[model samples]
Target chain A: MATSHTTEAVNLPSAVQERQRRAKFRRNMFYLALLAVGLVAPFVAYPVFLMKILCFALFACAFNLLLGYAGLLSFGHAAFLATGGYVTGYLLASYPGLTPELGILAGTAMATLLGALFGVLSIRRQGIYFAMVTLALAQLMFFVFVQSSFTGGEDGLHGVPRGSLFGVIDISSNLAMYYFVFAVFVFGFAVIQRTVHSPFGQVLKAIRENEPRAISLGYNVDAYKLLAFVLSAALAGLAGSTKTVVFQLASLTDAHWHMSGEVILMTLLGGVGTLLGPLMGAGLVVSLQHLLAQSPLGNWVSVILGIIFVVCVLSFRSGIIGELSKMYRKNFK
Target chain B: MTMIFGVPMAVFMGQLTLGLVNGAFYALLSLGLAVIFGLLKIVNFAHGAQYMLGAFAALLGFRYLGINYWLALILVPLVVGGFGMLMERFLLRRIAHLDHLYGLLLTFGLALIFEGTLINFFGVSGARYATPEILQGGLNLGFMFLPTYRAWVLVAALAMCLFTWFMIERTRLGAYLRAGTENSQLMQAFGVNVPLLITLTYGFGVGLAAFAGVLAAPLYPVSPTMGSSLLIVVFAVVVIGGMGSILGAILTGLGMGIIEGLTKVYYPEASNTVIFLVMILVLMLRPAGLFGKEA
Candidate 1:
């Protein structure tokens, strides 16, 4: 009976084709808007700051794809972020002529591979155990980085040059770097949005709501999750690589567990599953940091952030975009 | 000089002792984590921070209030535990109804606040907590020399663990606490005041962590970032032990600590990674953990 059902579903080409078309259209519209922001935003804000926000936004978006869609909360995403940053930083520092685009590709590819390796080990457990495992792996990485001489051992690789894009467009200019980062962020964000709304994404949501149902539906549940994990890791790598160039340095802070927490905060504060929420959240948090730095409240930033987190979890589970989505759904329905 | 496996036996014993000392801390910290997880169903990401708070509490008590080590040991845990109670009542209670992941995030946020506050006040470079005059020296054995304070820490931590184990496994109060953990509504139906029980359980867990901090201050430098670094290793210990079993948590922590020490003796580079390696191997062989029941 199961084999018959599986065969029947596999043979249904027209239905799948229709579903694919709708998914593609929705994804395309998202990319178009993201591209618009990437093109226009550099002129409006401090390009360096905008670049930072974009990098963090992409990082948060990647995180959301896993936790928001797959119901898998990874407590140690900094491991991947750090891994990508360090690899890219090392390559850029060692190889003088490495282009920004190629450096980012190398970093993203490395993160994707690491994500797959870590995913297989982590996905074995669910809920709390999954959080614990990822955190442990990330910590192990932290210690490795701490001892490795190439990472400059706590001082981190400093004064990293913003190599040109394809050896032509100099990313040294704040505006150029901002646009470059924005482009990567938009591309990464669009990929995440696409994956979450695709058939694969539906399978993930099914797993999140009810794993038994997803399995009974004859889906390869583990493979779907692994794919999501790798995709998330790749996007995170893109963010980290862009960040290395924008900041003109990659340091221990980028690889620290605190960075992982920061990314999670951005995702939660914005709206877990919403496309634009993470970008807004990244902006809000980075801006808040800037504002606080200019005031006595800088010391209390973490305290305030903590208070916000607790309140949001308790009273505002639906974040800014999440709340808007609810209102939109109500009116439309 | 006697040698074992191409290394001096003294060096081997020294690493073993250091590992055992670390194991003691791991056992205590993981024990608190297991208790919190068992009752609250939250991973208590703040456990390490709370432990750091305990050490800082001791340091502050001495620096400003003239509170000595002995008094601080008794007073710090109570203060930290009280803080934990307040957090549970005001902060954690609100999120108890949400997904367990929310609780984890909430605690994580609290950890950030705690660490940041400490850094702002004390700065990043660590403060030193001295060993009291009475416990300053070492005891000479035929084979090895043991620091008096180290011996005290090992003894005290063991006593605390055993006492906690005995209280929960052998007493009526423990029965109530365990029963509450099993079915809070049912226990509350019996007029057990389960809410208060949970509050006290969280306090007890936090207090245990504080107690470890007090013990650890003399051994390690007191710093704001201390908790964040140690939290991950403790999480690994909890995973290896399976949060389901109290004894498992304690045993795995101690065993892993010893393994870490042994690795340091042989291949110093892998010392930090040995626990994670063990976690992976355990997941492959027995996904639930050696003592953890299958979910």
Candidate 2:
């Protein structure tokens, strides 16, 4: 708007600003394209499968918020996820008149509380100890789930009616459910996007890069880490809650250590630090699992998963999106 | 029969012994974890898988190759420790220079591979290994009857834990390991082969897990998942004890196991979660762990 008038006022580094603007433009374009793809995805493929991917994708993204940005690798994130699912399932099953959204909200809230508990205990330790503490705490929760009558024990908390959204929109239909999940995914994704780009995210990144340095720079390192951990757990819970609503079941598998491990694989395999990396990772892993589960090689899915983990850690450390973005930055940027 | 806490004394004592036996397994497993972590700075996530391998190895050998329980005890550790050494040299060594979490991740993958392959071959229904004739039958007490094999497990685990403690705390080889842990570069400058020591340390640490597995084979079903499940509880024990002190791991393991067993008699429901509850309490009071120095 002021191309000529403001130009002579100061050397504004307009070229650098222009480059940043172009980058933002390209990023927005990519987002719009992705959103467009997501919109038509249910029509092109099965709605149920798309919803599953979206739920887990949000989960991976939530997990990435901790491990990638905050540099806190929680080995028990499944605790939060399962907490959300079970709470939602229980509430829905108990309150026949309760709306689906409220049950999901309740689940997410419980998960956030769990995240706080998990963070308070495990955040004290660093590196390997932190992972171990988280895993231990989650196992504790797993036992609770196993013994609790609310969980229905080995049979799992089942027969959860999807009900109507807000008692208004009947979302039990597959397409309706897909859209509902998509909306929830977008909201969660938006929250993550905002958090990552905000100044808080910058500080979290700093802490991840160098905690001592961040501490020296006056950041409350524990508080930051705890906040990040809680946020990640809450989002993971949200994913789990939505998943239960979609599937109408909450099983013990949701809270198992393997679930925790699977989330890490998704984040690592997709790209640790990148924005869209987890989504891509979740998509691939979920699809791979689905395909393998249906095939004769189904029994060996875990072996393949382990092989993927070894390969990722040993060689593909940057993951699919990480490498792709690296190339894009090198060439396109 | 006398009643203690409103339960039959025999049942109470039986549960206590069972708890203590479980604790022995915990002590053995966590001791290996502590030893390995001391040198590698990596939590061997697959230690549980290795323990499972030990059980399967012993069981399969017995079933097909006529390997006796005693023979399996001696052989399984060597075989599993050899496997651990190879893992260190190849998969683990590659990521040694990266973040310690990568090592955890790699081991976790290896754990999955071992667990997955085992479960694939032998479905979840576990196989049983009869206690050897030498340890068969039961010991009659005034209260509960104690299985001879169970008593032997307690004895063997005690000997193993004490021997490990002595080897690490009182011996010259342990001195080298301690020195290496303190500063590998300094140890290397002192003409000790640090890398070789590291490899051996990992092997020995994992050998402890294998020993526990072989010991466990007769007690529990020779299932693929037995180790992975118990591994988490040991992790709790490690967190409660802190990961540094071998003695701490042993004591905490036994104590937690006993507490768990008592809980089974008293509340029944909380037995599975009691150790974790203690862990939470410990984390709140002493973030460094009960035995860990404040970091």
Q: What is the TM-score of chain B alone in each candidate?
A: 0.98, 0.98
The segments of candidate 2 whose C-alpha lies over 4 angstroms from its true place after superposition are A1-12, A331-333
List residue ranges in candidate 1 displaced over 4 A: A1-37, A331-333
TM-score of each: 0.93, 0.97
lDDT of 2 by residue, A41-72 (tens): 99999999999999999999999999999988
Interface RMSD of each: 1.4, 0.7
CAPRI-style grade of the A/B interface in model 1: medium
Evaluated with TM-score, which candidate comes out highest?
Answer: 2
List each candidate's DockQ score: 0.68, 0.86
